[model samples]
Target chain A: MTAAELLSLTATISLVILGIAMLIAIIRVVIGPTLSDRILALDLLTVIAMGFVAAIAIRTGLMLYLDIAISLALLGFLATVALARYMLSRIKDEDDQP
Target chain B: MTALLATVLGCILLLLGSCFALLGAVGVLRLPDLYTRMHAASKAGAVGGGMILVAVALVSFDASIALRAVIGAAFLLLTTPVSAHLLARVSHRGGYHTQTTMFIDELAAASPSKGTLEQ
Candidate 1:
């Protein structure tokens, strides 16, 4: 296969693999027994989604999508951190109780 | 020749990264307890995702794509450990359950007000 064909082929396969990973992460979020589990799954999901965006950017030969992927990477950390802080405050409240 | 070489390298990296991602996803399910699973998903997921970014940069070989990919990968590497530590701290404080084999309470030990938080 030619160079373009090879890159596109790899992009397709990578997308398929990332799709599977994202699916499993979604399942965990839906059925996770603990708050942390669900939060972690959400984080993983965002990262996987960014990977999807990156793969698409590659396959389509678009540099602009890379900007989206970068912002997603930066912004995704906010959710996990916020949830963890919420949990921390709840624990502190519990500790404060008589 | 360089084009072919770059494609081969990018393909290899992409596939390897995807495998790492798949491993982390599976570990998220297979592992017991929030902490261990955190170890699995956070670290592996970040590394895998970073690898993919690198692969994308290699394939494109342009200034804009490479710059953004590098920034993204650096952001991921930096934030992953912070988030994982935060998650662990929250879980420890929230009294999340752990498996029987996990018997180290280092954080609780440091606090001194600790009174058998392990389950």
Candidate 2:
């Protein structure tokens, strides 16, 4: 019932929840019917990963880990944008076929 | 006393944030179509991640660390919607038309081509 105990308890629970979320997102990535679905699932995975990183930082009391979370957010955005552009080009190429 | 209060607040934030994240994952897994899945993944997922980041800021209680955490959360919030919009537009242009079960087709209705919107 101490505050430190409460903090650790919540941190552990958060980690468990994030892990399950990541698993579900992986399932979507594996069985998603379309390319967009898969990409969307991947994006969810990255967000879940961010939550994991934050939870760990809270547990460890290492505030520096937040830097990794920041970098990850940027990287995920770039990756999603790149994938979308790739999908667009592929579709355009298909249309150009005689 | 102040330390205890901070810890208590941090714990609540952590639990709330994680539960939101779990809900987002479930929505992504169970939604019937790509568009609906995207809706859940983008909005809920972003909010969940941002909340956790904010929780990190609260627990740390260091001014510098708190700044970084808030910055990361804000960046996450800013980018998720843009990326979702990009994905949706690309999918639509790629001929991934909306399902027939849906009652509305705003893009198609607004487009001159009737069914397909312009790139």
Candidate 3:
């Protein structure tokens, strides 16, 4: 097989693997008992999504997907920070009640 | 010859990276505590995700695209640790205790207690 064909095949397989990983992360986000657990899962899901975008870019020969990956990364960071802040405020309130 | 070797090596690296990412997700799910889970999620996820990005860059062979992947990887590496640290600090201060920890927290002991207000 040609090198391009091989690379394409590899990209397809990697994308499938990444998709499964993202699914696992999603399950964690859904069933996590604690807020921190959910946030952690969500963060992972974003990273996996970034990987997926890269795979797609490789398969399709388009660079635009990289832009999408960057946006996802930024969003993930914001979400984690917001969750941390919320958790911190909640803890302070709980400390005050006793 | 070089092209064939690069393609095979890239595929192998990509596969390894996916495995690490899968393991990271499993760690996130199976680990017993928030801190440990975060350790797995952040470190494994960051490295695995970065490796996959590198593999993609190698396969594509476009300088701009590869640079973008590198940028994405850099961002992940930088952000994951800071976020994890923030979460851990917040959880600790919020009174979340590790389920299996055996030692008294010295930092908690060192802090002066808020004085009781007279009614």
Q: Considering every candidate listed, which one attains the maximal DockQ?
A: 2
**Interface C-alpha RMSD per candidate, 1 decimal:** 3.0, 3.8, 5.9
Model 3: residues >4 Å from true position, as ranges?
Answer: A94-98, B98-105, B111-119
DockQ of 3: 0.49
Ranked by TM-score from best down, the candidates are 2, 1, 3
Each candidate's TM vs. the true structure?
0.91, 0.92, 0.86
Which docking class does model 2 fall in? medium
lDDT of 1 by residue, B1-119 (tens): 88678779988888888888888888898887788888888888998889889988889888777877888899899998899899877676555633225677776566533112322
Q: How does chain A of every candidate compare to the true chain A by TM-score? A: 0.93, 0.94, 0.91
Candidate 2, residues B1-118, lDDT tens digits: the string is 7877777887888888889889999999988887888889988898899989888888887898888888888899899999999998887776566542567778866642212322
Clashing pairs in 2: none
Question: Model 2 compared with the native: what TM-score?
Answer: 0.92
lDDT of 3 at B59: 69
In angstroms, give how far residue B114 of model 1 lies from its true place.
8.2
- Candidates' lDDT values, in order? 0.82, 0.84, 0.78
- In TM-score terms, which candidate is top? 2
Model 2: residues >4 Å from true position, as ranges?
A: B98-100, B112-119
Q: Residue-wise lDDT of candidate 3 within A1-98, one digit each (tens)?
A: 88778778888888888888899899888887777778889988988887788778767878787788778888988988998897776666656896
